[model samples]
Target chain A: MIEIKDLHKSYKMGSNSLHVLKGINFNVEDGELVAIMGSSGSGKSTLLNILGMLDEADSGTYVLDGIPIKNLNETKAANYRNKFLGFIFQSFNLINYKTALENVALPLYYQKMPRKQRQEKAMKYLEQVGLKEWSHHLPSELSGGQKQRVAIARAMVAEPKVLLADELTGALDSKTSYEVMELIQNINDQGNTILVVTHEPDIAQMCKRIVHLKDGVIVKDEKVKQVRAKVNV
Target chain B: MFNRDRWKEILEVLTTNWFRTVLTAFGVFWGILILIILLSAGKGLENGIRADFGDIATNTMFMWTRSTTKAHMGLPIGRNFNYKTEDVETLWEKFPQLRFISPRNQLGGFGGNNNVIRGLKTGAYNVYGDYPEIIQQEPMAITAGRFINQSDIENKRKVAVIGLGVKNELYEAGEEILGSYIKIQGVNFLVVGTYKKRSGNGNGEEGQKEIYVPFTSFSQAFNRGNNVGWMAITAKDEFPITSLKMGIVNEMKRVHKIHPEDTRAIGFFDLYEEFNRVESLFGAMSFIGYFVGILVLLSGIIGVSNIMLIVVKERTKEIGIRRALGEDPWSIRKQILLESIFLTIISGMAGIVVGALFIYGVNALLDANGPVDMFMNPSVNLGVVSAALFILIISGLLAGFIPAQSAIKVRPIDALRTE
Candidate 1:
């Protein structure tokens, strides 16, 4: 579902330039659950940003769902992100003023979907994430686990081709993190391609495959026995 | 563009801090209120001043002879001259631009010895001998009987038109006034009419203490044969009396054999020029009203802009999330602009409503009491309201412009990174 070859990215901080992603090659097939593991400066988040089409690489070949992602303008990039990719940020990133149902319906709103249908679709996703009863509550009113579930429901409501999660449970406790992981695994079980970015090894174990990045380069790639998160939850 | 979701989002964001929203709105409210009030007050003052002119023809001049400053054609300098009855006919035949020329003769002064007496009552009063057309030039409402007409002048009838003040002084309440004979300087003249000045300047009370008699009768009774005191002349609607003044004066100078360049001779008052001055003063007042009102409104718009910038800053994270959720940059910009415009229009409408109520209350108070001097019927017309609404829309756009730009410039990635 995604492809990246020799991707490179750099940031200019005053006079010095920091290379965040350098000569990285990665690929993931459809329906695969992959965890990208890294240290603080390992360039894992930068790769996911490029894969999610949030940022562009200075030099690379990247394709998602048979469409190459290169030199796209902001508007087209936004459309592609809406149609083909879903994102779960560490901070939940739900608009605080909107109720959980409204937050989940935001992507469809941008898609120009009719309001009635958008609400129904968002409600289905909220139900799938086990947050149907909490849909009317705001993000601030929800627990970390419930908020993460709402974020997951929002991310999946549009049924994007790929799901990108950057430390989705970073702000939650271990118990809540496991609960969110169980939800993610359940979603991936339904054949949605998902990428989880994490620094924690236990979280990485929950995925079917692991990709390790160190100092802007991938050091290891392996397939492993998937540990089902619902068993722990 | 008419999206329910967008509207809901705007309402939610704006209502989150309702106090700040109301505070921001108050600026525009006060601005429009002051603008309407200034314009209405200017209109009121114009109306009041215009009312002082009353029904008198503004395009009229009152001309009288003065002592000549220079000798011409054997006429000595400093020679005091009086315009004769023949000079009135001479002017009428010479100047086709003149509409009405009324020769007037007067006897007695207000503070002089008592010149009028009836039944042991004696009082000092001014009496004017005028033609029939003088009523059209210097308008007054005849309260009883009729004004002196052409038959009275032709037949040399001893007829008079007394003012309401003269009537009150000479006759008791509910007494017979018309056809009654009153003695003027020991000459009995029949009272024909009673009049009151329509509008009061400062001399309204004094205007009611005058009397009018036919010109021929005054000349015969007073032994002033064919002599004219002064003339009230009105020009045609197409011509202005001020422009025709020099022409008429020069003709009179040539007829009376006065020096052509004698500036002091034939002294006259140009009512048209004075009326023009008052008209220009009205224009200046309106200009000042607009200038000051716009300045105040501009400050209010700037305040709105400042508040919008703060609002955008406060909602940066929210904007970031919307952008990340595939909201178009234009859509985000539009949302901010819509919120700003909505706030401005609402506040401006409130200001208009309150201002209208204020003007209504003032008018009601004025109606309950009497008319106030130099201020009447303060109001703004529909055009002014439409212009204010147009200004509100444009200023709303201007106020939202900077903040909307800042909002759209936010990159979702960087914005999402902000704490």
Candidate 2:
């Protein structure tokens, strides 16, 4: 569902330029669960950003779902991001003022969906994430695991072609982290293509394939023995 | 355009800092209130001043003869001359623009010794000899009997129109005044009419104490021999008497053989010129009111703009999230602008309501008491209110412009990166 060839990106910091990504090639088929692993400043997050259409690469040939991504204006890029990609952030970036259900319905609101249908669809997603009873609660009132679930529900409600999770469980405790991982695994089992970006080896192990990055270049690409997350609830 | 979600979002964001929002709104509220109050107060002053002119024709001037300052045609300097009855006909023939020219003669000056004796009720008063047209120039209501008409002047009838004050002084209360005889300086004349002058410039009492008699009978009785005391002349509506003053004076100077440069030969009071001055004063007052009111309103708009900028800055993260969720840039900009406009319009309407209430209260208080001098019926008309509303809408747009620009300029990635 995604393709990238010879991707390169650089950032200008006053006089000196930092090359974040240099000549990287990657591909993912439909329904594959991939983990991009790297230490700090390895450009793994940068790759996820380009894949999610949040940031453009300085030089690349990238295609998603048979559509090439190049030189799109802000409006078109936003539409593509909404229709083709979902994102889960480490901070559980739920709008603090909106209830969990409203937050999940926001993407559909931008799509100009009718309000009644949007609410119903958002409720269905919230139920899938096991947060039906908590949909009326705001993010501030939810625990770390529940907030992450709300964010996941929001990301999944639009049924994007791929999910891009950037250190999704980094801010949570280990027990909560496993719970979120189990949720992600369950979502991946339903044949949704997903990309997880993390430095944690245990988190990388939960995926079916791993791509390792070192100093703006891929060091290893290997299939992994998938480890299912065990959760109490 | 009419989205409930958008409205809900605006309400939520604005109420987040409700105290600051209220304080920001007060600026616009106070500005509109001050503007309306200033305009209405100016109108009130104009109304009060205009009322002082009363029913007297504003386009009229009163000219009287004075001692000449220069000698000409064998006439000595400082020779006092009187206008003749034939001079009135000359003026009418010379100036077709002149509407009415009434030559008047008076006897027994305003504080003169008891000039009229009537059944042991003697009093000092001023008596005037006037034609029928003089009533049109210096208007008064004929209360009891008829004013002097053409028949009285043509036949030289010895008849008089007594004022209300004259009636009160000469006759007892509830006594018949019309068709009665009052002897003026040993001449027995019949009182035919009674009048009341409308109150003007604190002179209503003095005006009602005067009396009018036919010009022919007065000249005959007083042995004035075609001599005119002073003339009250009114010009046509299209002509201004002030502009025609010098021409009339010069013509009179020529007729009486006085020097052309004898400025003191004929003294005059131009009511039209004075009325014009008062009109320009009103215009200046209104101009000043608008100038100061707009300055205050401009400061208020600036305050609103400043608050909007702060609001956009505070909601940076929220804007970023909305943008990332495929909210178009125009939609984000529209939300900020909508919020700003809503606040401005609400505050402006409140100001208008409060100003109207204030004017109503002031009018009620004035009604309960009596009219105040130089201020009456303070109010703003519908046009002014509509103009204020238009200004509020434009100010809302201006106040929102910069902040809305800043909001749309935010890149979703950088915004999402911000805490």
Q: How many residue pairs clash in each candidate?
A: 0, 0
Model 1 chain B scores worst on lDDT over the 10 consecutive residues at B1-10
lDDT score, candidate 2, position A48: 86
**What are the root-mean-square deviations of the candidates from the true structure over C-alphas?**
3.5, 3.9
In candidate 1, what are the lDDT values of residues B1-419, reduced to their tens digit? 57877788778878989998899899999999999999999999998988889879999999998899998998799998888899888888888888999989999975788899988787778999999998999899999999999999999999899998898898999999998899999899999899988756988888899989999999999988998999898999899998999998898888888998899998999999999999999899888888888788888889889999999988888788777778888888898889888889999999999999999999999999999999889989999999999999999999999999998787878788889
TM for every model, in the order presented, reads: 0.87, 0.85
**Model 1 chain A: worst 10 consecutive residues (lDDT sum):** A224-233
Q: A1-233 in candidate 1: lDDT tens per residue?
A: 78889999999999999999889998999999999999998999888888877788999899887899898888888888889888999999888888999999999999999999999999999999988998899889999889889999999999999999999989999989998999888899899999999998989999999999999999999998998887886
Give TM-score values for chain A, per-prediction.
0.98, 0.98
Candidate 2 per-residue C-alpha lDDT over A154-174 given as tens digits, one digit per residue, 9 for 90 to 100: 899889999999999899988
In model 1, which runs have C-alpha deviations exceeding 4 angstroms? Answer: A65-73, A189-191, B36-47, B70-103, B110-114, B117-119, B131-133, B149-158, B183-188, B214-228, B235-244, B247-260, B286-299, B356-387
Tell me the deviation in Å of residue A182 in model 2.
4.7
- Candidate 1, TM-score of its B chain: 0.88
